[model samples]
Every structure is written in C-alpha cells, then in structure tokens.
Target: MSCIGNCIDHACIKSFHSMIKRELVYLEKFKTREQAIRRIFEYIEVWYNRERIHSSKGIMSEYENL
Candidate 1:
C-alpha cells in the first residue's frame, strides 16, 4: 500500500480522492457515519465506476476504460 501524499505508485489513489472530494464529500452531509460510509461505497462502486465520465480517460468511466 502507498502512503497518502506519495504518488509514485499511487496516482490512482490521489485521483480517487480528488474525485470523491469533488463529487461527494464537498457536496453532501450525512446524519450518521454509516450513512456516509454507505454513500461513499455507492458513489465509488456505482456512480464513479459505472457512470461518471473522466476527462483524463477520454471521458470514460473507470469500468468503461478497463
């Protein structure tokens, strides 16, 4: 595993954090920790992987790119 701030082999980690911050963290509030966890899971597994378009990957979702 790579440390946070170390992007040598973890550009994907930084990119994932940036996407989560931009699309979810800065945009919503949760009443409970479980809610936040669930939403984050859904955001990453469903929306980000399946739906969101990434410009760096030619407007394709990670799943699509793969």
Candidate 2:
C-alpha cells in the first residue's frame, strides 16, 4: 500500500513537471513576473488540472475521476 502510494505520488509529480515544461516553459515567452504567474496559474488551474485528459485515468481529467 505504501509503495503504491509512493509510486502514485512520484508519477503525479513527474506528470506535473512535464506539463509545466511542455505547456508553459517551452511554449511561451513571458516578459514579466506577473505575466508568467498568470499564465502558470491558468495552465495549472484552468487547463491542466481541470480540462486535460489523463491516460491512466482512462482519458479523463483528475477532477473528472474525483
């Protein structure tokens, strides 16, 4: 059980990192701190966490699974 929990946690972290890299860090150019913050928040809250599909969850968002 503990191992499963750890694996899931690690996977979640890795997925988040990948999402950040792919969606924000690599895709956009931000000239100011506020712009970066707003973009990151929008990607994480509005898109990645809310709308993006996860293969592990049968192509459903985490919010959807919950």
Candidate 3:
C-alpha cells in the first residue's frame, strides 16, 4: 500500500470549518447544543451541499460537484 494519498484532506476540513464559521456559525445565535446541531445539519444537508454554489465547480452545488 502507498503511504501518501490525499494529504489535502486536512486542508479541506480546515477550509470547510472556515466556511461554516463564516456562513452560519458567526451569523446565527443558538441558545442550546440541540439547536446548534440541528442548524448545522440543515446547513450541511440543505444549504451547503444542495443549494450553495461552489466556485470551483462554477454554478454546481457541492453535491453536484461530487
């Protein structure tokens, strides 16, 4: 097996965190852990993957980019 593969995964995660912070975390005021979890789930499943237009993919959502 090869030792090196997709070292950018860490970077990808960091970038995702940065984006989530900018787009949702910093904008919303959640009162509880439950609310935060629910909102984060919706942001990922509904907005980020399905609705948000990824610049690299040009008009296509992250799901489409996959």
Candidate 4:
C-alpha cells in the first residue's frame, strides 16, 4: 500500500506542480504578487481546465468531465 504523507499519496498534485513549473511558471515573469496570482488563476481556470488536454483523460479537458 502507498504510504500517506504530504506528497506520498498526492502524485497528481506533484505532477501538476511539475507541469506548471515547466509549462507556465518558467515562461512568465510577474512584477507583483497579484499579477502572479491572476496569471496562475487564469492558467488553471481558463487554460488548464478548459483548454489543455490531459493524457490521463484521453483527449478531453477537465471541464468536459463536469
């Protein structure tokens, strides 16, 4: 069985962090905390949820699951 810890059972969250770092965070520069927040919000709500395809979901976005 998988052990439960901060990240031991949260592989998807870790994958998300890695993906965001690779695909969004590393490519952008924010001058303020608000800007970063807004951009990350947009990335998750607008891009990641509605637009980007997930391999695990087999060509559909998370939005389609709802």
lDDT of each: 0.81, 0.77, 0.84, 0.83
lDDT of 1 by residue, 1-66 (tens): 677766587777888899899989889989999999999999888887674446555675556568
Q: What's the number of clashes in each of the models? A: 0, 0, 0, 0
Best by TM-score: 4
Q: Model 3: per-residue lDDT, tens digit, 14-63?
A: 99999999999999999999999999999999887774445555776556
Candidate 1 segments whose C-alpha is farther than 4 A from its true place? 1-6, 51-66
Each candidate structure's TM-score, on Cα atoms with residue i matched to residue i, is 0.62, 0.55, 0.64, 0.66
lDDT, candidate 3, equals 0.84
lDDT of 4 by residue, 1-66 (tens): 376565668788889999999999899999999999999999999888774446565775566668
- Candidate 4, which segments miss by more than 4 Å at Cα? 1-3, 6-8, 51-66
Over 4 Å off in model 3, which ranges?
1-7, 51-66
Candidate 2 stretches with Cα past 4 Å from truth are 1-9, 51-66
How well does candidate 1 match the true structure in TM-score terms? 0.62
lDDT of the structure predicted as candidate 1: 0.81
CA shift at 15, candidate 4, in angstroms? 0.2
What is the lDDT ranking, best to worst? 3, 4, 1, 2
The collision pairs in model 2 are: none
